[model samples]
Target: MHTLDQLKQYEKEFIEKGYFVLDLNNMEYVKEASDLLQKHLQKITNNSEITLYNYHAFFEDNDKHYEMQFQMLQFFREQQFAQNIIQSNIDVYQFLLGPDLEIQTEPYLRITRPHKPKDNIGYHRDTFYGTGPGEISSVIPFINLSEKSTLSVVPKSHIIPDRFFKLNQVVNTEVPKDSKRHKMGFLYAPKVMDPEIRNDVIPIPLKRGQALVFMLSIIHGSEENNTDYPRWSTDIRVRNSLTSLNEAMKAGYYKPLKDSATTQTFERLSQ
Candidate 1:
């Protein structure tokens, strides 16, 4: 586990750019997490009655993909394995976010695959469930490589004021696109490339079992996953405990989604 001082150094770097990557190297605990995920996937595939998330169904059939997600959620909720990874993150996150910060597990695991020319969510900020500052997030890459479907982020984009990141003040509706902050990268206009912003856009690659923490207000997007292989990862949001309840209440966010057994499944073709 990282001590307070070491974590602080990362915080400084993150504030300057909105995120930082932590390398677990070959730590036994990290290795255990990876193995645990593999085992969980195997078990979930054996079960039926799961539904896949919209994006996951693209590669595998509906039933089969749904089962894959069930296994993924199992991995997220597995106390033994999830704890090892979560505990390591909490140590550092506490310092970066605050002593009161806690981890909120998402309902599904992500299996991003190579994109066709048309595939992309376009430029956006992750303000789906929160408003204002103090909103932060952490993503753990269960996959084994950095270039494996990595996400692109605009450095320091979180520094933008609340008015820009916030939902509507008039109708109280969420801002569909963060038009004010400016998107700078593939498939969109980049703030870094703009002579006005002067920030450089860089591609961040993460190794297997690495955790990348960043502010939610950061401007970011993913390039098309060019490889033939699919990329698997899980996003765990970490926020000040006080902020969790408020953010979860905003609209579409789930703290620890209420269900357990129900999940998206992928059906295999006949043998």
Candidate 2:
């Protein structure tokens, strides 16, 4: 846990650089989550030797891979893994997002297999998808990440004026027709189409037991995993409960993670 003074410095850095790295120190929860995932993968693949890094090798069909991804997502939600992670690092979240916070109901489980370009996400801001500016994005890697398999971000890009760049909604046509992503429509992310912007983007290498917290407005994405090992990570959004939220963001997409004493008292009195 960071001291109050250290957290203040991190807050300044996050405001200036659009992101900050936090040391979780609590790897027990991460290990438990990863173990749960591996067990699920083993059952799905019907191979006791299945591991997260090598699970991709078992799927010869893209449709099967998509189906597995959806199943994993459902399992995560059913197990409340996201909430468990948040609670494990409650102190850090309280420092970053305030005492009263709300977390994404279903955190994104990003699996970038080695040499898989189709799994790569494009550069964009969460604000483009109706997330409020007050929301913060957090990425926790289950395994060590190298530059080739880590997330890339343009430092300070969150503060850049919108007029400086144009956004185009890019869709992944490669998504299988029967996949849930396909049914969600072609609208994926509003990407910055200018190739010149790539010059400023840099991959952030992360070790296990660490997290990357960034402003939602930051222009960030990941490239194809070129490393020999697969990348497993979870990205979730959190914000102060007092902050303004859009209707879409509030539509069962977020759940309260922390409540202030005043809020607790009010709820009790109301009841």
Candidate 3:
């Protein structure tokens, strides 16, 4: 847990830079989660040698690879992996957000294989996906991330006016036909179409034990992985429970992760 002074400094830095890298206080839970993923991958691939970085080598078919990824996402959510990490790092979250906090129920798993442009996300802000400024996003890498495979963000871009960039809504129509898509509606996210804006985006490298926490409005995305090893990471969104939430998010997309004493009291009294 960080001291009050330290947390205040962190908040100031976050406000100024729009993001910060944090070293997780408890790596035990992180390692446990990583181990669980590795075991599941080995079981599904039937190859003991398969690792997060080299799992792409086992699948030649794009559909099969995506199917594997979808299955892993299901497994990850079913196991409540994000909840464990949040619990372990509750202090930091509370300091960043508030004591009353809600977390996105379905955390996103990003698996970018080397030289796979299709797997990379385009530069965009979460606000384009209906998220509000109250929400913050955290990215946790399962493996060490190099500059070539890390997330890129335009610093201080969160405060930029929306009109400054030409944006386009991009729907992902590449899901494997055989696999059951998790969300029914068109899965889409807005992408920044301006060529000049791309120049400001810079890669943010992170180690296995570090997490990148940033404002949702920041213009950010990953580049095509050019390294030999694949990049694997999971990102979850969190917000103060009292803050405004989009209709979809309020309708059960987000769940309570922590509650203040006042909130708990109100819940009990209402019940």
Measured by lDDT, the strongest candidate is 3
Candidate 2 lDDT by residue in tens digits, 1-271: 6688878877898989999888775778787888898899888778898788887787646677667777887787788876787788888778877788988887777777788766666677766677785689889888889888899999999898766886665655565544575432223433545777778899999987788889988888875888977788888888888988887643777888889999999999999
Between candidates 1 and 3, the lDDT winner = 3
Which sequence of candidate numbers ranks them by TM-score, best first?
Answer: 3, 2, 1
lDDT of 2 at 107: 79
**Which stretches of model 1 miss by more than 4 angstroms?**
3-5, 44-59, 78-83, 105-107, 116-122, 161-201, 243-271
The residue-level lDDT of candidate 1 at 141 comes to 65
As a whole number from 0 to 100, the lDDT of residue 263 in candidate 3 is: 93
Pick the TM-score winner: 3
Cα RMSD for candidates in order: 12.5, 2.4, 2.5
Error of 1 at 205 (Å): 0.6
Model 3, range 150-218, lDDT digits (tens) per residue?
999999998987888887655455633323443311144335467676789999999988889899888
Greater-TM-score candidate between 1 and 2? 2
Better of 1 and 2 by lDDT: 2
lDDT of each: 0.53, 0.78, 0.80
Tens-place lDDT digits, model 1, residues 86-196: 665566765665655444543335555555422333335665334335556666666654553676677887777645542322221221243211110112322222222
